[model samples]
Target: MQIREARADERDALLSVHRAAFGNTEGEAAGDTIATLAAELLDDPTAQPVLSLVAEADRELVGHVLFTPVTLADQAVQGGYILAPLAVLPGVQGRGIGSTLMRAGLEQLRSRGATYVMVLGDPNYYGRAGFATGHQIKTPHEIPYPEAWMAQELVSGALAGLAGTLRCANALNAPEHW
Candidate 1:
């Protein structure tokens, strides 16, 4: 197994994994939109610094994880990230590809000086990676799934006294067609 930055040629395979992983909830059409948005967002200058990691086995893309710039308002803090669209091929789920990608991604972000990271995902899964509910920190986003909205402070005291709306990258909020 090898984990590395995804190359341009691997985008389609990665999209296939994403579609298989999220298609049930997001629908097949949504997968195309997700892939398109990911491609467009990757080219944006402001989002260029974000990281996209892919896990491959035998030269086949098996899983993917994306981290983009995010901000928390209370501390006027701006050096964090948002984890989105983490996906693994259905056949490979529960075999640790997702965990591996997440671990590598978080370590990379911390090494890159990211102060914190937020993810909207399953608490049971993400909590194992050091994520805690945003409610514990009084995060400003009134997310419907409270347990799903989690935050991890990379640096000690990174989130101390911080409480604010998490600002996602423009790409996420942009019109679907963009």
Candidate 2:
């Protein structure tokens, strides 16, 4: 398997993988849509310091991960990012594609001077990638899933004494039925 930045032509295939990987989960349909919009918006020229990576095997896309700008309520802390919609095709799960995508994406973000990275995901999965609960860092986002809402500091002391709501690019509204 190989990992690389996603090309324009691969969007649909990546979306297909996302749908398939997350389709059965609760609230995933709308999450998938939001993820797609986030990816598209991040590609806009005006967007700064965004990173999206994909993993492929035998010429078929297998996984995707995205990182975008985020901020703490305190203006002093800048260059934060959010990780969302990490997806690996069901058939490809447990093959390390997700981990590879995350490592590469986080490295790229750190190299670009990102201060911190936050993710809403399984603690066990993300914890393996160096993520810890926001409470550990005093994150302001009062995330409902305390355990699932996590953050990692790329730069030492990046999140020190910081607190604020963790808002997505667009104040994402959950679907009515959810």
As for candidate 1, its clashing pairs are none
Evaluated at residue 49, the lDDT of candidate 2 is: 55
At residue 27, give the lDDT of candidate 1: 87
Model 2 Cα lDDT, one tens digit per residue, 67-164: 87876544556778888668888787998889999999999998898888988788999999999975444334345566877889898987777776
**Model 1 agreement with the true structure over 1-178: per-residue lDDT tens digits:** 8989888888778878777777755788877676766765677666658799999998889898888887655556767887876888878799999999999998999999998888877899999989987444433445566778788888888877777666566676563421
Local distance difference test values of all predictions, in order? 0.78, 0.73
lDDT of 1: 0.78
Q: If candidate 1 were superposed on the true structure by all CA atoms, what would the RMSD be? A: 3.0
